[model samples]
Target: MPSRTRTHNHQLSDPFAAVLQPPPDETPAALQARVEQEQEQKRVSDQIDDELRKERTERKKRSRREVKVLLLGQSESGKSTVLKNFRLKYAPMQWKAELRSWRAVIQLNLIQNVLTLLDLMQDRLAQPDGPRPGSSGGPSSYSPPSYGRTSMDSTISEITLASSRSTLNVVLTQKHRLLNMRLSPLREVETDLRRRLGAVDPEFTFANGEDGAMNGVPGERRKSAREFGVRGWIGALGFPTSGAARNSDEPMPVDKATEILATLRDEIISLWEDSEIRELLRAKCLRIEDRPGFFLSDTARIANRTYVPSDNDVVRARLRTLGVQEWRITLEHNESFGSEWVIYDVGGSRSMRHAWLPYFDAVNAIIFLAPISCFDERLAEDPSVNRLEDTLLLWKAIVSSKVLGKTTLIVFLNKCDLLKRKLQSGIQVNKHMLSFGTRENEVGVVVKYLKDKFKDILRSDASQPRTTYLYATSVTDTKATAATLNIVRDGIIREHLKHAEFV
Candidate 1:
């Protein structure tokens, strides 16, 4: 047994002994030098370990200090707009850096508007009894059908309106055809821009079930097959990361798109400004101006080679958020509450709501945007679902969530400007929501009614006792939104401090 133990020990130690063995003819000075070298290596290793420990400590501290906020709302409820407003206020430098990149998005918006108009014109021209040269007021003025009490009734009304419009006809002139032919090249530019922006499907068609269906004739399917979206905002602009690309003389995809827009500027302006085209759009109830990312009004400036997007323009720019986007902003001005903030801008479509559950954990606050203007509208993904109803359901689900029991809830009854416009245009709220109950259709009353509804949900549905802050916001108006955001920022920071036990 002793011999077996000795053999096993020898086998294990032989490799270590051989590795530790120095040169056969080693001098004292050489041995000293080897020891010094090993000492230096050990010092470096120890230093690295010390650094790793410090880094871990700092990360833990930051996790406690970081203000994590999640922007929540349905699609087109102004979540992204609110995020842009935050960046505009807190991260001005980063926002300015991304401004030039938005030129492509603005140009794409213009092209899409033009293309949709052209398609509508083509569809109108195809009708058998198209609009005569001077036809005026012959059962031609279009009025949207009234919204019924239930969502099913609303859907039926929409379907009825769509079916009724299919029988009406309109016409276009030779000038319109020539303009369409000239603008055809923009289709290729649109394709190139989509490629650069990382659009999931280049040939994707935006169905008319949402707001502003092409020609407002949903059944006829005169929709434009142009939608530009990116998987992420980072590097989507195709801008240079390092100084290497700046030194090169090559033009980027955005540059080419800019050139095309400049070349076709006159045609685009003419098409947009045509009186007959305006009349046709009015007749079809297609208010292209009210649509998100509408830039045709500024075609002259936007299409110029020297065009640069202003702060308002960038805020108003529409880029669909495909997934949750993390934006870190270090508050330069306010250091008392916290320095670093992480804002998660999540996709708000019904299909994307499933991805939102995991993010609910550890979120410091949730800024829920409900577009009250969409009360009379149906969800694009599920036509049967009313948008306002969807928002209410989502709000109930969020407030009742045990995972978010301790989270701070902030509700922005967003898009109030659009809501006012919609109300002013004779859209009654009670027709769509019976619970609105013959209240005044003024902006203040509507906002209060909606606010009360949200408050009621919070009072009844929250899993734990919590406080909710509510605001009436038109996020597109940066100036007003900036003021509102200041209050929001301070409130969130206060809650964060309380959670960290610093208050």
Candidate 2:
């Protein structure tokens, strides 16, 4: 419920350079010989383990094959969008919510996805990592029975087993700084826009963009994130609520918020009851409630469309993709020759990610965002930077956390189409460093370039050298393919397999 306080000025060169960890020690030759000798007697036991795994995979092939996936990133990163799109084949537009809350749910899913990714990494890495975070290697053969750092129910959990087939545990830990890069909704926009409709409204004051956000006053007070969502309607909306109020007690005026949603829903549903209204809603494709107030008319209508619906309860519908099924799991071992994984996921705001690491003592892999196309842009020009800093802060938190290399690390270079375009167009973006007057499109560069320039950010005590892979993607569609993600996911799993061999 707290807004992140990390500022760009706080992000500096990694000062911790002397702490790289040594690789895991190999079994001494004599110890290895002894183990091999012991293995002669236990050959049947090892064979049984192999046979069980092969059997499980074969059995799972005929089933739903549940794989736990965790998604992690800063606030507003495309983690949720990517996940929503990933399962598009199963159910499109399932996780609906008011837009702002949609972002919140996305954040939660991100955390869940992180946990799920860890489950996959751990299950795949199950072969060699030493005792998992919470397992003791029993026939229960299940992941550690604990929830993540911020399980949705963070309360007493009921343990239920899947009908026993094949499943993977994953964890998603997303630390979103700013929940949404938007302004207040339902303000007197008609009054303000009336002064200047077609033109970039003149009342929108932005003499400069400092402290990373593009909303600024060159020499005076800067505008808050609330203003940018609607190009500065603050006077009409009064001062936007503080971070605390906005996050918890009140997010926008509840009365106005509900009214807006109900109005849209009524308008859209009326169309279904009558053909004319449906046509009108389709041509307009709604974009209101600042940023997160997305929704729809009926559950049936929600299931019927892929684009933003034009009608009631548009907030949540816009936020969630239909039937979002993201997940993450971490299993810590209680015995030897086995290990555990802790997963994290999307729960908008870096604050959510900040709550995920302790459970990660069992983490086996991390899914990080490396929007390569972002490397060619500057944060200042990025229209959605209100929440970008939180992501970096979250990354900083990860690189500096205690879960160094109990697992493998995978960095997805998302938004690949954008990156590919920039590279083809000969544009070079730098995320680690930024200059004045940089444009929005350039912010991608900074996001992509953060690591190459910030050494301390990725330093860990583990000897594996925390791995990263670039996954280029475009959720709204610009020639992005699931294959790109497959390449990234497969690469991470393959390397994870090699790493697990030592466990």
Candidate 3:
């Protein structure tokens, strides 16, 4: 019987097999070369396999070590800002790319402000015949000279209306220029931008309405985020209500949107800063201060040709979290903690709270943010309910959750900066918050009072009480937040390691 020969087959593809197989009737030198080539290829393949196996081993170890953190708060409670800060710290390149998309959102915010201001101005101008709504209607104490009084007053009022109309007319033209020049359906603009960058997933829309509470929380009503501003803005602008074909013109370059705002920057700022316009707004009870991106005052800077939003600007830019967004970032600073960390930023509105229960059981820790500055503010969705009251209720629900009872809880009494400013401005907290009666309206005093209130709730409501840590955080301050994040990271790592040891 012929001697049998054994040949090892590595699963090489057809192209590789042809090159690897030795020719028949090969000479010794040729056979030696083929053997060496085969050995070399095998060595490379084995090295790759070794590396992959090591990676798998490491992945398994990391899966056991992974930490999941949830950011919980009411809408605009600064949860997303906290998430952005994390991205800024650990994934700057990605954050910088994200800023490009934010540019459009910023522009929309600016447009929204201008549109609102103009509408109020027009309403006031239209009503020159009587005292502005909400204004004191008592007759003037000093009567003007009777001579030609009626004719002169009528002439002056007509001229004032004519002037405002002229300004409104100009504003109307610019508004159309911006809206019609391919600015609608901001989603497509963002999507096109991502496509240009070779991104497969659609970009996240950061506008602050829809899929959230109508007022800014979940309980009001669910509206499309698109319907919040862009879709409805056309009718609001007093333009033809007819379904004007969506600005199908080529996507406006980010820089082009900036340029459009720049060209109209003077008009926008003038209207914003006009003392007369300000008076009218106050009379109309249109308080822009409570709204997001009140940029009329910052027009010059926002409209600058080379303007790139700073970290603070991006934080101040309002976008309501519509649903749960997850980010997986490799931990670089606290290497002892784990290989990766996953963070979930859920929409803080009431309706969105339903989504939080699923995450509670899985999250290793919770960063609960409450805007202490919001004590005097009212919930946008429900005006009768105080914002601070809503925050307190939300905090109670989170800390008391049965599923999350064991999760590490870190409370961030956020917006301390705004709180300090509000106190210093001589705004009486007791006047707005009756419960705050008889207490000193000082920053330190108010902060401690608020902190104690939160702690009392936690102490009373937690299913299984543990030490709940609190921080007076102003997330806009990167250095301060970074330091706080480190403390949080270290605390989490220690707990994780201790838990693993016990397990």
Candidate 4:
């Protein structure tokens, strides 16, 4: 067998050494021509290598990620569908729950993304039982799953049954396998330093809504490390997600998620920069993945793969904090250029309005979607005021002290299709609307209006990373919509991310 060497640091096709070698000495003019030819060859090789990587990913994928994007808005704003979308993507195994309190349900389609098996875990259970703080009882009989156990999917969305709390806790964890799975998916390896350090449970609190005070636990602080479900209770611990899957003795294309994430991350940042709302940093929460590496590989290979089972230390993505409700984050990556995003979608429902605040400080960009189908009599005579009220709150928070203008805000005039439909129905708009004679024209004027205001209103001493223009976007679940998004992605986002001068 061929012995493995240190992992490749350059693009697979180019090799690090190839990048370092200088061209043969030649006349300055001839060197320029030679360089162009070299560039062309490298591009072709990149395309080929891209195809190879995609093939590898698709050959064994089984789990499709469904992100639980928490949406927040007032009573009338859309919220239910956002939660429903999450269910459609990450609905659990045998999930059975009344819609009485929850928002929506989602079950991801994996057949289309068979290469993700390496990314999926069959052992869905991730419960760790622990006695109360002062109790001396045995560790909660529950444990994060032994190495390589797998759970078969039972085709039920929910089950209302009774059982001991121990089994119930285990079952609850199993139902949310995908969510628990994303908490980094690979566990930390056992380390002496981690064991030596003492653990402390820092108080954890988050608001249920924007401007909503942190309502979790106030009177007491639980030692986070002593908790049962806590990994390395009473201390800090984590290992590489990539290292767990690859044998120290074996070789692999990428050893850490960061390299994979870095390549993917730069592309996402580029897309954000190119957005028509790139200045606004809006219209970007969309995702693209599962095509495998750079191109499509045979779907059949993805549909079939020999299963290898082992369990060592893979980080579980579950959010486990005492006195805190559990949450699932199923983060996934795709070969497509725009698959790295985890958008907190704006769903139009009353229940979802409370989820918007906590993450505002963390996101690098914010897409403030303003629907065009409003203020036509049913909404309000004062459309902008009504719209501004909700939006102003969001803007204030993102630019607030916690975020400190760290995030870029992108405003989008969403549902442009609604405008076209209105025009077709003989609804009269401004003179500019008639001049364009189509939905596209009406949107252009609206975008122009937003751009001027963005430049005018947000030009302030405190705005560190400047805010930019707004774009009119139409997001429908269709091919034309995808094409439209791709154009904005290429022409706008890509351009700005590659802006070397800014760096």
193-242: candidate 2 lDDT, tens digit per residue: 32232212212334453322222211011212221121222222132333
In candidate 1, position 415 carries an lDDT of: 89
lDDT by residue for model 4 over 341-449, one digit each (tens)?
3445432222333445566554444545555433131111111123323443444444443453644455555556655654455444332122223334354565555
> Which pairs of residues collide in model 1?
none
65-149 per-residue lDDT for model 3 (tens digits): 8888999988778898898788777665545545544555566566666656544444434444544334343221111221121
Candidate 1 vs 2: which has more TM-score: 1
TM-score of each: 0.85, 0.36, 0.67, 0.30
Runs in model 4 lying further than 4 Å from the true structure = 1-333, 336-340, 346-354, 377-385, 388-404, 423-443, 460-462, 484-503
| Cα lDDT, model 4, residue 278 | 23
How would you encode candidate 1's per-residue C-alpha lDDT over 156-222 as one tens digit per residue? 2232232123223355778888998899999899888877777753223454554433223442233
Candidate ordering by TM-score (highest first): 1, 3, 2, 4
- Candidate No. with top lDDT: 1
lDDT of each: 0.76, 0.35, 0.61, 0.31
